[model samples]
Target chain A: MTVSDPTVGELSEGEILARILARLSPSRALLGPGDDAAVIAAPSGRFVATVDTLVHGPDFRLAWSNGFDLGWKAAAVNLADVAAMGARPTALLVALAMPDATRASFVEHIADGLRAACEALAPGCAVEGGDLTVSDTLVVAVTALGVLDAAAVTRSGARPGDIIAIAGDTGVAARGLDLLFSHFTDASGTPIAISPAALRSLSDEDGTALSRQLRPFPPVALGPAAASAGASAMMDVSDGLVLDASRMAVASTVTLDFDRQCVGDDPLSLSGGEDHALLATFPPSAVLPEGFRAVGAVRDVGAAPVTIDGEPYDGESGWDPYRDWDSARG
Target chain B: MTVSDPTVGELSEGEILARILARLSPSRALLGPGDDAAVIAAPSGRFVATVDTLVHGPDFRLAWSNGFDLGWKAAAVNLADVAAMGARPTALLVALAMPDATRASFVEHIADGLRAACEALAPGCAVEGGDLTVSDTLVVAVTALGVLDAAAVTRSGARPGDIIAIAGDTGVAARGLDLLFSHFTDASGTPIAISPAALRSLSDEDGTALSRQLRPFPPVALGPAAASAGASAMMDVSDGLVLDASRMAVASTVTLDFDRQCVGDDPLSLSGGEDHALLATFPPSAVLPEGFRAVGAVRDVGAAPVTIDGEPYDGESGWDPYRDWDSARG
Candidate 1:
C-alpha cells in the first residue's frame, strides 16, 4: 500500500513495527534492533552521548515540512551535537511518539529520511534502535552516541588571545526561514498551501534558502577535524552566533569580540538560529584548519561576555523554544 | 521557592534548567550534563543500549501517580531492558517534554525520582545527561546504557529440553494494577480523588499491590548472574507471562510448556504484565540459580509457541499499549 493509503491506528503495533524494521539497513553495531538492546563497539574507551527532542508544534510545523524533512532534520541536529564534541557519531537511538491517526506511510517516509540523512551527512553512523509510543502529537527524541578520535573539545577550554573560527555557512537557515514565512504565509501569519509547480518557480536563492531552513547541512566532519587540529573549544551554532559565543565566553571565563568585516554584513549572522555550523577557538599561533574562517578573537575576562566591532550589541540573542512564538517573531 | 510556588511558565528555560541541574548528584560519567554531550567510560569494548518512552495519557496519569512515581517508574522500566540482555546498567539519559504550564518543582521531583531509582534498583548507575523540551503534553524518554560482564544472552538461544526459570515475583504488578483501578475509580471507570486519610486506610496487601504497580523493582543483579551461570536465553517479563513466553518461543524456534503446579495457582501468574522479572532458560541438567524458580520447559518447535500444563491455553496474552484501553482491559 502507498503511504497515504492506511493510518497507523488501523494496524496492530506489531504490524507497523515489522514494516518499519524491514526498511532499516544493517548497522555497523555489534547488535542492532530486534533485540533487548543494541551493542556498539567503543574502542575509544569512552562514549560521547547527547539527546534532543523535537515536538510538532514548537519545533516544526507540518505545513512547513513533511515526515521526510522532519526525520532528516532530527538526525542532522542530534548528529551535530556529537560533532560539536569532536567525535564520530556511531549510533542513534530514537523514540517516536505520535497520534494514532498518523498515516503509516508517513512513518515509512520518516524511516527513509533517517536512512538518507545518515548516509549523506554521517556515513558511518547508523540508526541502531528505537522505541515507538502513542501520543496526542508527534514527538521525536533522539539519543546520539559517538566515539572520540581524541580528547573531547569542550566549551571551557578557550583562553584569552584564542582565535575564534567557524566552519560552514552562518545565517543561511534563518534566512531560509524568513523567506518561507514571507512567501508562503497569508497576511494573518498563517501558512498558505503552495503547489509543486509554484515551488518550482522560485528564484535560485529562495530555493536554496528554503532547503537550508528545511534540512540544515551541519558541518559534521569539521568537528573531528577541529579536534585533531588542536581546537581548544567547539560547539554547534544552533542558537545564533552572538548568544552561542557569549555561552562559550561565559564557560571559558573570557570575552569574545567579533570582527564585523569578518562576520559579513548580514545582521542575521548574529541572531539567526539553526545554522548548525562548527564554531571553535584555537591558540593565536595555531594555523586555522581547512574550511574554517576567522570570525572573532577571544579576549581577557571583561564586563560583558561578547561584543561585535569592539562594542556591546544589545539585541535578541537567539531562539528560545519556550518563549511565546508570536512575540519572539516580532 | 518551593516546588509548589512557581510554574515553569513563570521562569525562563535557563532558570528552570539551573534549578534542575543543582539537584542532580555527580555522575560516574567522564563528563556530565551542561555540555554539548556527556562522555561515559566504556572499558568493556562494547556498550549495550536501549530506549523507552512514557507518555502521559496511555502510559501514565497524573491523577494516579505523582512526579516522583513517574520518574521512578520510567527509570525502572528502561533499566529492566538492559537487565534482560544480561548487562549491568551504567548510565541513563533522559529527555523530558512537557507543557509550559507544568510546575518547576514537579520537574525537580522527577529528577529526584530518577536518582532514587538508580540508587535503589541498580546501584552505581548514574543519570549522565538529558534534554528538556516544550510539548503540549508531558513525555519522558529514557536511553539506558549497560556493560557486559560475560557473553551477552539473547532470546534466540533456548534449545529443546532447556528448563525455563524466573527471578522475582510473577503476578504482583498486575495485582497492584487491579487494586489501583478498583480503588481509584468509580463504577464507570472515571478516577475519584481520595484524601490522604483514605489512602492511609488501605490494607497492607492493597497498599503493597498499588506500590508495585506504580514502581516495579526488577531483578537487576540476577541478569549478570544468569549470564555467568550459562543461561541459554533470557528476557524481561514486561508483558504477561503467556505472551512474553510465546515471544521467546518464537525467537528460539521452540515451544515453552509450563507446569501448572510449578507456576502456582494464580491465573494472573500466566497473563499478568509489567512485572519486570527476569525469565531465562538453561540446559535441563543445569542446576537452578539461587534466586530463580523453575516454571516450565522448552519443547521442540510445535504448532503453537506456548502451552500451560501441556494444554493449549488461549486467553488474553497481555497488554498492548496501542490497543483500545476499555476493550483491551479484559
Candidate 2:
C-alpha cells in the first residue's frame, strides 16, 4: 500500500522470484533453482513424494493466519506426509497462485516462512524448484520428496498383537481451532483480523495451543526412527485420532483399541484433527522410541474398526464435522 | 440433471477418487497411490523435478478447451520441462482444485487425458500421486520428475561453435492461438464454446495447428536422445524461438545467429510460442539427432543476444504478445 512496498503486479516475475530466492535457504540438491528443472539426489534408488494444497478464503484459512503462517502450514502438512512414510525429506517443489495485487513484501514473508519451517522441522530439506501463476483465489501447492532410511512404513502392515503409539500432540491444534472460531469471528461467524488486545487475553495454555495451530511442529525426525525401531505400520494423523486409526484398522484388517488413559479423556482429543501426528504400530517387544508413547494395541477385526476401552466408540468420527467441507468450501 | 450422472458435491472424496483411479493407468512406481506418499525409483541416484500450473480463464485457457484438453495440456507442459532437462520423465504428481459443482464425469475425463498423454508422449510414465481440493476456480498444478540417462543438460552449456537445433514444431501452436481468437471469440473478445460448423470450415493445416495447440505432443523422447547424442545445452521452447533463444544466449553468455533458411522467414516462427519444442545446442561436428534439424549457430557475446542472417533482428520477441499477461489475468 505504500510507495516503497510495491505490489507484485508492478514488477516482473523474474524480479519477484529474485526477491524470494534471496530469502530462501541455499539449495543443496544436485541442481537447484533457475534451471529448466532441478536435479535431486535420491541415493537409495527410491524416493517418497507427496503433494498437498492450501486455498485461501474466509472460512478455510483463518483471517489471523498471515503469509508466514500459510507458507509454514503448507510446508508442514506435506512434510508430515513424507515423514509418515518413514522417509527423511530432502526437497520441495512449490506452486504458488495468487492475485497480482498481492504485496511483494507478503510474498517475501512466505518465502521466509517456508525456509524457517524446513530448517526447524526437517533440517537439510530446502525448496529446490517452484512455479508461480496468477489465479482468482490464492493457492499454495507443495510437493515434498524424501529418501527412505528403511522400508516404507505403510498402513497395512500392522499386526493384531502390535502396540500402537503416537509421537505428536493429539488435539492441541483442534483446541486452537476452537479458540480461533470463538475469539476471532464476527457476528456472522466469519473470521476477522486479530486485535493485539484479543491475542494478549489468552491464557498461557491457550496461547500455546493457538501457536501450535498456526505453526505446527510435527515430529519429522521421529518417522525414520520409528521405522528403524521396526515399526510395522505408520500414518500421519491429520483427521483426528479415531478417524485416522479407523483408516489404519481398515488397511491392516484389524481393530484399533485405544486405552482411555493414554489417549486422554477429552472428546476433542478423540475427534478433533489438524494435529498431524505420527501414528505407528510397533512389535510388542520393540522398545518405544524417544518422543513416542504407547496409546493402545491392535486387535483382531471386531464389530467396529476402532474401539475405546473395549467398547465401540459410538461418538461421531473426526471427519463427521466436515464430510462435505471440501465440497462446501468457497 | 440426470440421476446416473451426479456432481462431485453429490459424492464423497473417496468415491470420486475411485472413479478417477479407475480411469488412470496402472501405477509403475515402487509404491503408488493409496499410500501416504508414492515411492518412485530414481535408479541413477538423481531425479529431475519441476512444477507448473494451469488456471482456468478466458484469455488464458480457451473456453473451447474441454476437461481432456486441460488435463493433456497440463501433463504435456510439465513433461516438456522435465524433458528440457535432458532426462526421461518417470512420474507426474497432479494437484487438481475445482469447484464443488463440477461434474463427476468431467473429473474422470481429466484422469483419462492424463493417462493418454503419458502413453502417447512419454511411455512408462504415469500419474504416481496427487492431491484434490476445493477451490473457487479450477486449477491444475502438475509436478514432473525424471531420471537422467547421460547427463543433465542446462541452458548455460552453450558455447561458440555449437550448432542450434529444434526437435518439434514451431509457430504452429501460435497459429492455432490466432485461429482460436479469430473463430472462437465474440465481439468483446471473450472465448465461447466452439461451433461445430465453424470447426468444419478450417483447412487441413489449420486443423493440425489447432489440435497441436490443444494437446501438444512435445518431443519428450528427443530430449534424452539429444543429451545422449552429445548436446551441449537444451531447453523447452514454450515462449517463441527468438525469446527463448535470447534466454539461452543470456544464460550461456553467447550470441545466437540463426540462418533464415532453417528458421524460416515467418514472423510467427520467430516470436510465437506454446509449441513445447525441445531446443538444443550441439558441437558443430557432432551429428544432429534423428528428430532434430539445424536452425542456427552459437557465437561469442555480441551487441545483440540473437541475430538473423548475420544482422541483429529488428523483430519483436515472442513474449511481446503479452508482456503483463500474468499480472493482468484473473
Candidate 3:
C-alpha cells in the first residue's frame, strides 16, 4: 500500500531515485556504482569537474529565494566552473538538506530551478541524480562535470605582453546585491525598510542579479575560442574582475596591469560574482577574437599587488562571503 | 587590503572557487558558460549522474562523522547511484554549507573524506569543483557523474518467473544505531556510564556501520555482470531490499515472491540501508550470475500484497526514511 503524508512522503529520495535510474542505460566507461565505483570512459584521459554550496540566510532567503532559484543556482555555479576550465559540461548531481516540514513544492521548485538552469546553461547536462534530506536549515549543493576535447586553458599560460580580454560583462550581480541590500538592515548599519514598489523593483533587478548570482551566465563557448585564437592564459571571472584577474597573474607568475577605463562602467561589468565571464591573456600578435573585448595586458611579476589604473584601492578589495554578508542582504 | 578572520574567512566560497577554477583547463565539448549553457560532448550521447545530500544531525554527527567520512560518503552515495546504473564513475563535484566558525580543519577533513571515498570506490573519479558557504549548521551535498559504455540496467526489465537476488549484506547500519542507543543505557533502561574501551568498541562498530550507512560500498561492477549474465532487471537496494524490490516488481508489472529463508537472519542482512548492493532479477532459465544468489521469483501481479513464502507480511514491510524516523531514536 502506498502511504503518503504531507510531512513524510511515500518514497524516500533513494527509493524514488532507484526507480528513476532504472530507466537510464549504463556506459562501458562507467565502472563502479549503479553497484560500486562507476567506471566512466575518459578517452581524453582527464575529466573536468567543479562544486558549490548554498546556505540559508547567507546565500538565499526562503521568502525571497524560491526553491527553483535554489536549484538553478546550485547547478549554475558548478557549470560555470567547468566553463572556466574551457570544458563542455556533461552531467550534474545535486545534494540537498532541509527541514522535515519543507513543502514538497519547495523541493519540486528546487528541481524546477535545476531544470531551468540546465535548460539555459548546460543543455543536455542532465540532472542525472541527487540526494535529499532534512536539516535545521535549507542547504543546496551542486557538482558539475565537464569534458575537455583537446586544448584546455589554464591561468598559468599567460606570458608577458599578452593582451587581456574578457568574454562577457561583470559586476551585475554585485550591483544586484547592492540593490537588494538597500532593502534590508545589515550589521554594518540599521537601514529603514523600503516600499514594496522599490523592493519589488530591486527584487526584479535582484532576480536578474540573483539569477546571475544563483545561475551565473558563464561564457562556456569562449574557452575554446580563446584556445584556438592562441590566447596564452585564461580563466572565468568568478570573483570580482580585479581580484580574479590578479589571480590569473599570480598563477602565471606574472603581473597583470588592467586599465580601469578599459573595463566599461556597467555595474554588471565591474564587481558582479554571477556573471561567468571568461577573462584571458593572449599574445599581442594575435588580434582579440570576436565576442571578446580587450581589457588590459600582462606584465612582469612584481612585489606590488594588482593595481587598477596604476593605483591601489584602500576600500574593500572585492566580495567576500563572510565579511560581506551585508552586501547580499537586499 | 585583504581581511581574514578564523571565525569569518577571507573570501566567500564563490570567490575562493573562482580563483581556483582559473587554474584548470577547458575542453571542446563545452558549449557556453561564463555566458550560458556549457556544451559538453557526450561521445556516447548519454550521461550517467546521481546526487545525494548529507545533513548534520540526521545523516551524520559532527562529533563522530569526521570530515573525511562526510566527504567520502557524499561522493560514495552518488557513486552508488552511478553504479546502480551499471555505469563507470568519472567525476564528482561537492557543495558544502556550514557555520562561519567552522574550523578550516573541518573543511579540509571533508575534502579528505571525499578523496578517501573516491580512492576506495573509483580511483579515476576526481573532485571536479564545488561551492562552500557559511550556514547555521553543516550540510553537504554531492553530485557524482558516470559514463555508460553499454545499455544501462533499469528497474523495469524484470518479468514473471525471474529470480531475484541481492548483493552485499544489510541491517548493519541499523544495528549500529541499536548499539549506539543501548550502550549509553542498559536494555532495562538504566543509565550507564560506559567505559571508553566499551565506547571505542561501540565506536568501531559504529564506524563500520556508519561507513555502511554513510558511504555505502555499492557493487558497481555487478551492473554489467548481471546484464551479461542475462539478468532481466536490476536496481540498487537503497531504502531496503523489500521496498526497493517491490518497486521493481510493480514497475515491471509483476508480483515477486521472496523466500524469507533465502534472506539471511544477520542483522546486517535485514532492514539495513547503505549496502549499495545491486538486487537483480533473472529468468528461471538463466544461470545466477557469479556474484549473485537467488532469493525469490517474480509472479503475476495480484490483489494480495507481496508475500514472503506465499504469506503476507503483517509486520513492518521494510525501512522508510520518513516512516522509520519515529522509531529511529531507539
Candidate 1, residue B2: Cα displacement in angstroms equals 8.8
Q: What C-alpha lDDT values do all the predictions have?
A: 0.85, 0.87, 0.64
Correct interface contacts retained, every candidate: 0.75, 0.67, 0.46
Model 2 C-alpha lDDT per residue in residues B144-210, reported as the tens digit of each score: 9999977799999999999999999999988998898888888877777877888889999999898
Which candidate, 1 or 2, would have the higher DockQ against the true structure?
1
Q: Give the range of the ten consecutive residues with the poorest summed lDDT in model 1 chain A.
A: A321-330
Can you write out model 1's per-residue Cα lDDT over B1-330, one digit (the tens) per residue?
653558776777678788777766677888888788998888877788999998987777788778888888999989988988889999999999988788888998888888889888889898888988888879999999998877788888999999999998788889977777788887877656655876799888777777878888888888888888889999989888888888999999999998988886576877888888989999987877799999889999888899877776777788666664432332
Off-target runs (Cα >4 Å) in candidate 2 are A1-3, A58-62, A320-322, A326-330, B1-3, B58-62, B320-322, B326-330
Candidate topping TM-score: 2
Model 3 per-residue lDDT tens digits across residues A1-330 = 975434324456565445434433232233322432233344564556566677777777665566766777777767766676667766665566666676655676677777667677766565544556767787777666666766667777888778888887688767655665555545664443444675566556565764565456676666666777887777777667866776777778888777878875454555566676888888998977788988777878876445566554334445567666643333
**Residue-wise lDDT of candidate 1 within A1-330, one digit each (tens)?**
643557777777777788777766677898888777888888878889999888877777788888888888888999999999999999999898988888888888788777777888899898999998888879999899999969999899999889999998788899988877788887988766656876899898778778878888998988899998889999988888888888899999999888988986576888888878988999988888789999889999888898887788687778766564432242
Local accuracy of candidate 3 as per-residue lDDT tens digits, B228-269: 677777777766666666777777777878898897545445
- DockQ of all models, two decimals each: 0.74, 0.62, 0.29
* Two-way DockQ contest, 2 vs 3, winner: 2
Alpha-carbon shift of residue B26 in model 1 (angstroms): 1.2
lDDT of 2 by residue, A1-330 (tens): 656877776777788889889989999898899888999998888899999888775224647788898889888988999999999999999898877777888888889889999999999999999988777788899999999867899999999999999999989988998898889888877778878888899999899888888888899999999999999999998878998999999999999999988987787888878789999999999998999999999999998999988789877568532144653322
Order of candidate numbers by lDDT, starting with the best: 2, 1, 3
Report the poorest 10 consecutive residues by lDDT, candidate 3 chain A: A24-33
DockQ for model 2 equals: 0.62
Candidate 1 residue runs with Cα over 4 Å from true position:
A1-4, A324-330, B1-4, B285-287, B324-330
